[model samples]
Target chain A: MLDEQDKNVIRELQKGLPLVSRPFELIAGRLQMSETELIERVRSFERSGMIRRFGAAVRHHDLGYTANAMVVWDVPDGAVDEVGQSMAAFKEVTHCYQRPRHPGWPYNLFTVVHGRTRDECVQISEKISKKTNIANYRLLFSTAELKKSSMRYFE
Target chain B: MNLDDVDKKLLKLIQADLPLAPEPFREIAESLGIEEAEVIGRVFNMLEAGVIRRLGAIFDSRKIGYTGTLCALKVAVDRIDEVSAIVNSFPGVTHNYLREHTFNMWFTILAESKTKLDEILDTIRQSTGVEEIISLPAEKVFKIRVSFELD
Candidate 1:
C-alpha cells in the first residue's frame, strides 16, 4: 500500500540504475524529496515487500561461460523442502523454486544453471541430483532468450 | 504498456529477434504490411508504457566469463530489506527476491572470478551483518535459456 510518491521513487529505481555516485539521490530529487527521505521510503517499500530489490544483470554471453539451463525436478512434497534446501546449497543453481506443476510438466522443483559448456552444465546437474537424491529430473535448456527485465510494478 | 494491435505485433516480432539488417525495423514493417515509422512508434510506445522494460539483448552467462552461483540468506524477517540492499549493492549480484521459507532472501550473482565472488559474498555478509548467508555454488548445470515466443 505505497502512496503515489513512494511508487514514483520506485518506478525510476528498479531498472539497473545508472552507475553514479548518488543513484538514490537522483531518484529522490526527481520524486521531490531529499536523499534521506527517499532511502527511508525505499527501505519501507522493501520491508513491506512492495519492492524486491535494486540490482544489476551481467551480459553473460559477452563473458564466455556459454550454456545455461533450467533444471526441473519432481521431488515429493515433503522432500521438496529438503531437496530444494540442498539444491540451494550449490552456488551454480542461480534460481531454485517451487512452481505449480502443469499436466505435461511433472517437474515441480526448478532451478537455473549456467556453465562454460553443455557437458559441464550437465555434470553440475548430475552432482545436484546425487546430493539431493533427486534421481528423477529434467534439464530444459534455453534455445533463445525472449525477455529479461526487472518487473515494473508502478506500470 | 498501452499496446494496440500493431504494437502488439511489434512486440511479438522483436520480442524475439531484431534482425541484422541496417534498417531492421523497416524490414519488420514491410513484413507486417505497415510503415517503418509505424513499427518504430509501436515499439517505442511499448517501451514508454513499460510493457517493454528493455530493448536490448539477453545473455547466456556461461557463454560469457561469469563464474558464479545462487545463494540464499536466512535473514530474519525484520532484516530482509537490509540484507537485500547489501546483496544488490555488489555489481556481481543480480535477481534478489523474498520468497516463502527460512532462507527467505534469495539472490544470484555472476562473478568474474572465484576471488571476486568471495569478496562480493564477504562484503555483502559483512555489510548486511548476516553470518547465516549460505553460498550455494552450483556443483552441476542441467539446462539453460528461454526461447522467446513470437506468437
Candidate 2:
C-alpha cells in the first residue's frame, strides 16, 4: 500500500543512512523533504507495520559467536504452535518458524541457534528439545555463505 | 580488531533504534558519556571491519506483498559452485548458502507473487538439473525479532 514516495524513501534507506550526526537531514534533502517530514514518514511506516525495525544489523560472526546452526524439528501438527512457542522463548534461538513439510522432509519447525562452538550449539538444541519434548530433528550448519544481502524492493 | 568497552557499548546502543533527533549520534554520545566525534569514528571503524552489516530500516517482506520460500537443493557436489552462481544470478535469491547435508545448497528466493517465485524456482531446477528441491515456505512465524547483546 506504500506510495511512490514511500518506496523511494525505503529504497534510499536500504542503501544505508548517511553516517553523519544528522543522517535524516541528508536523506530528507535528497528526497526533497524536510527533516521532520522524513522522520514522520518513517514513523508512520513503523506504525503501519511496514517497517519492522530501524536499527543496526550486527555481524554476529564478528562478535565472537562463531557457532551457528539451523535446527529443524518434526513436531506433531496439532502441537506445532505449543512447541514453536516453547522453542522461541530460549535466548539462544534467534528465528523460529513453522515451515511446510514435504513427503521426505517431515521437519515442520525450524529454529536457528548461535553460540561459540558446535558443541555449544548442540547443547542449546538439546535444551530446546528437552523443553519442547520433540526429539525428531536435524542440525544443518552453513559451510559457506555465498550471499547475504538485504532484498532490494526497488531498483 | 578487538572491541574495547566503548565499542561494545556503542554497538549495543546503535543496535537499538537510533534516536529520531537531528543530532542522533550526539544523543547517543551523551548517553554513553563520550564525544560525538568518538562515536562517529568508532562506527566508521566498525563498518570497515564488518562488525556492522548495515544501518538502515528493515521492512516486513510479507507486509510489502512479496512472497518467498526457503529452498534446499540436493545439488551434485562438483556442480555446487555453478548451481550457486545460477541461483545467485536471480535478484530474488537474497541468501544462498552451502550447508552440511545431502541437500547441501540452501537459499531463499522472494518474488512479487507466488507465480513468479515458482517460475524462478523452475528455471533454477532446469538450469541446474536438480530433480527435487525441498521448498519450505514459512507457514507461521513464532518469533523473528532478535538482537545479539555483546557482553
Candidate 3:
C-alpha cells in the first residue's frame, strides 16, 4: 500500500539506523514523514506478521555466555515426530526445526542446546536422548561465526 | 492503525527504549503526555496485530554463555512434518531456515554449554542418519540487529 517514495524513505532508514536518543525522530526528519506516520506503518507491518519481533540483538560475548555449539540429529523416519516434539520441550533449546538432507550425511533432525558451560550443554543433550530414547546424532561445534545480520526490509 | 497526535508521542518514547521500569506503562504514558492506559492500549493493539512479537531482551547467544551454530541437514522428503516436530522439541534451537539444496534441512540451535551442545547434535545424528551436516558459525557479526526508522 506504500508508494515508491515511502518505501525509499524506509529503505534509507534501514541502511543506517541511529543509535541515539529519539532515533525515530531523526529518521522521521530524513524520511519527511511525520513521526506519527512512520510509527503507524511499523505498527501495521508488525500486525500483518511481516515484522516478526522488535527488540535488541544482544551481544553474547559481552554477556559472558560465550560458548556456542550446534548438534545434528539422525532421527529415525518413523520416530521423528516423537523425537522432534520432545526436543522442542527442553528449556535450553531455543530454535528447533527440520530441513532437507545433504549428501554423505543424512542426519536431518537438528536442535540447539545452550548452557553456562560446556558441561551444562552436555547434560541437557544427555537428558534429551534419555527422554526421547532415540539416539543417532552428531555435534557440529562452530569454530567461527560467519555472518550475523538483521536484514533491512524496507529497502 | 490510526495514528493520532498522542499515539505518535507514545510510539516515539518506546521506540527509543522499551520500558525497563517497574511501571513502564506509567513512564511511557507520562512521556506521551497521555494516560498510562492510553500507552498500554497502543502496545496491546500492536501485539494483537503481530506487529510486536514480544517485549523482552533478545539475548546474544554467543555472548550469553551459548555456543550456537547453524547446522543444515539432509532430511527425508516424506518425513518433513515428522522431522519438524522432532526438531522443534529442543529449546536451544530458536531459529531455523528452509532452503532448497542438497543440505536441505537448515536449522539452528543455541546451547548453554559446549558439552551439552555436542550431546544434542549427537542425539540428532543418531536419530536421522542425515547424509552430511555442515555448520556455519558466525565469526564476525557484520550487522546483527535491524534498526528500523518508524518515520
Chain A TM-score by candidate, in order: 0.86, 0.97, 0.80
lDDT score, candidate 2, position B41: 92
How close is chain A of candidate 2 to the true chain A, as a TM-score?
0.97
lDDT of each: 0.61, 0.89, 0.57
Query: Which candidate comes out best when scored by DockQ?
Result: 2
Q: How displaced is residue B87 in candidate 1, in Å?
A: 1.4
The superposed Cα distance between candidate 3 and the true structure at residue A4, in angstroms, equals 3.3
Q: How high a TM-score does candidate 3 get?
A: 0.51
Candidate 2 vs candidate 3: the lDDT winner is 2
> Which parts of model 2 are misplaced by more than 4 Å?
none
Task: Residues B6-83, candidate 3: write the lDDT tens digits.
Answer: 644555455445543335567667766777776666766654554444443333345324577777776677866666
Can you list each candidate's DockQ? 0.02, 0.82, 0.05
| Model 2 chain A lowest lDDT segment of ten | A47-56
TM-score of chain B of 2: 0.94
Clashes of each: 33, 0, 102
TM-score of chain A of 3: 0.80
**Candidate 3, after superposition: displacement of residue A62 in Å?**
2.1
Order of quality (DockQ): 2, 3, 1
The DockQ-based CAPRI class assigned to model 2 is high
Model 2 per-residue lDDT tens digits across residues B56-147: 78888888789999999998888888888999999988998889988888999899899989999899989888987989999999998547
Give lDDT: candidate 2, residue B121: 88
Off by over 4 Å in 3: A1-6, A9-21, A153-155, B1-151
